[model samples]
Target: MTDLNQTALQKGADRALEKIEIDTLVVGAGQAGVAMSEHLTKLGVPHLVLERNRIAEAWRTGRWDSLVANGPAWHDRFPGLEFEGLDPDAFASKEQVAAYFEAYAKQFNAPIRTGVEVKKVVRNAEGPGFTIETSEGVIQANRVVAATGPFQRPVIPPIAPKDDSITQIHSAQYFNPQQLPEGAVLVVGAGSSGVQIADELQRAGKNVYLSVGAHDRPPRAYRNRDFCWWLGVLGLWDAEAAQPGKEHVTIAVSGARGGHTVDFRGLAHQGVTLVGLTKAFNDGVVTFQADLAENIARGDENYLSLLDAADAYIARNGLDLPEEPEARATYPNPDCVTNPILELDLAKAGITSIIWATGYSVDYSWLKVNAFDERGKPKHQRGVSGEPGVYFLGLPWLSRRGSTFIWGVWHDAKHIADHIATQRKYLAYRDASQRSAKD
Candidate 1:
């Protein structure tokens, strides 16, 4: 039965590929792309969503099986489809999240063409629309929405030394400790991914060394509510202070302890060896910076700043919020602040594996237009690109702090759809006027 259904779907996709023109071409079928497609469908626009793989491919394959959403199920729902059959506060696993997106696409009957990898998106030289060359066929679209998401490619630093003797894997490729060879693991980058992977490895009874870097350390819950709830109340998610082209701080969330705070201090106390930023790797010797203590202090300072902002917001609004519980310093134990290990021999430490949780970079090489800036980042105003018919979605701070998250992309999607509709209407009126003048 499933095979028959797939066959019918493939035939329909083939027919769609034969089409020479479409109203809009959405170049992704993740949460962002499906949301955009749903809005476009409501606007009665003829559109197609192209996915390189299956729907929600990132959640299906990019993440580990045990990985769950950082936010709760309630907060991760798309428009019109709240998470049911699960506890609202429970963290949805990777499989569950993927299934949610799949269900969303099916529910809306989103026009998504799976396995259709877009090769290039270039402006049509002979017309006002764009010519999208995909693996299936060429598609001419009046407007193109790039919802390829924030994490395009895993970034490994150029200075990272490579040796065939050690097994190195990026966080994207890392599944679990069991997949790695027998030895201690050195996890680099102190962001969410780094901390989570380090914690997992440590819990697996493997000796884990976590490299501490600049990061934000917000408590998972604050004042009897989740930190995200307070952030929403304080309007921090929509803060105007977050400037464009700035690297955003990572929020550490750990489901291991029922969504408790995951920070360097906490990890240090959990028998995980905390180290400074990895500086270099030569031969079997790995050198680290002497700035772990400073980084931890910086993180604490940032946390304090967040609390101060929340307090000021409460005062200004005259809202009687619950006072914070007695303050317990995060790093009370002097041993938590370890003496920086400037250098270590990987072989001597029995560290056979290195997991680089260094983060991701956006790849827009397939987009052939002047829409990108010098930094190769799309130059756009709240999802609307400088190019008339070009738009972007799922970009960090595209519309707000929540723009990149599943919960916040609906607004940007709706805005983009509406903008496209308005522009097309104006174009139609202009064309009619020109024809009448000619007559």
Candidate 2:
């Protein structure tokens, strides 16, 4: 729900007011856009990247202060760059990751114009390309890669009562444990963000209630290798999103405390209360579904399935890897799910704040293209859209399971760059003034 609109309002007072034209206009300066810039430059395709704010703005501000990447540094990075002053297995802090992107862009000398807010993009009135209305002025480009990413805005469920007595905020706005009021905290989602935040609060001596939802609980390491490496080796990273049973599979892996398996039971044993999916909220009372047991069972199922597949793959390959028995060991179900409270009054429970760790809702209102579906999702094959010259990148499951990862964006950009290289406009545009309707 946040953008650098205020910064845009300040405007680029230092730059000139002259109009601009290009063959390809890259929208965003995040990992995706920067990667696109690298490949376009390598392929001799001229392009410009327009960013509303500085590079890696989200990693610097949108996430929590204590957050680290879910994947380790070695397996989660681009092909040629290794994180500085960090071990390969270490999880790079948010600050380090942001710094890496800034340095990466500088290394390539990417043609990036920061602080440029693209207000709207539509077909040219008198030509065959796009006319972009920006805060600085106007621009024309034959092709545009919408690389702003999918997590444009946060989405909080409408179940919570519209009351101001208790503080509430989306996880994107959360920075640390001390910023919240002194009392119990209710986090309504069990994804990586919600679970990690809940763990931090409980460790800080605050009561935390986590609403368990559907998520894949993969071990941080399996068969002497991290799950990220296994995914790459097993070709799961390139797995198609259209495959069955992948409809709702958000991984709950975390790289905290030197990286460990994601265990909700362990969280419950450590004093963090686990509850089922949040149902509704009245004046101050909250209702929860009586499905906590089912939720825990589903997580257990996912955990076992991964172990089983890894074992089978190892046996088939005849790989000599040490057996990690703890991953398959069963533990007793915690009391939170077995004898849980179906409803509770927030005031009586001493819960003073609520954090909604729900996922994001994208905003493509500025994209005046006929490439989106009824739900506003882009109707595309991989990154190629039904509407020509409009491509999407850095979106989850855009091409495969790893499409959302940083390295995935890098490799995916190469494909897009190669495709654009086939166009006659790649080397040079005909002219800046005369863009015919058929062009």
> Across residues 314-406, which tens digit of lDDT does each residue of candidate 1 receive?
788888778884433565534635566889999999999999998899988899988988888899999999987899999888888888888
Clashes of each: 0, 0
Against the true structure, candidate 2 reaches a TM-score of: 0.92
Runs of candidate 1 with Cα error greater than 4 angstroms are 1-11, 14-16, 241-246, 311-327, 333-336, 434-439
Query: Which one is best on lDDT?
Result: 2
State the lDDT of candidate 2 residue by residue for 1-439, as single tens digits: 0112213322433564246667788899999999998898787666778899989899999999988999999977888688989999999999999988888887777778888898999987675778888888887788889999988989998887788889999999999999999999999899899989999999999999999877888788987899998878778899876457756556688888888887898999999899988999987899899988887788888788878888989999999999988778765788987898789899999999999999897788888989899889998887888888888989888878888899999988988888888764533464433566456
C-alpha displacement of 192 in model 2, angstroms?
Answer: 0.6
In model 2, the Cα lDDT at residue 309 comes to 86
Give the clash total for candidate 1: 0
Candidate 2 stretches with Cα past 4 Å from truth are: 1-14, 242-245, 425-439
Q: Superposing all C-alpha atoms, what RMSD in Å does each candidate have to the true structure?
A: 4.1, 5.1
The alpha-carbon lDDT assigned to residue 70 of candidate 1 equals 81
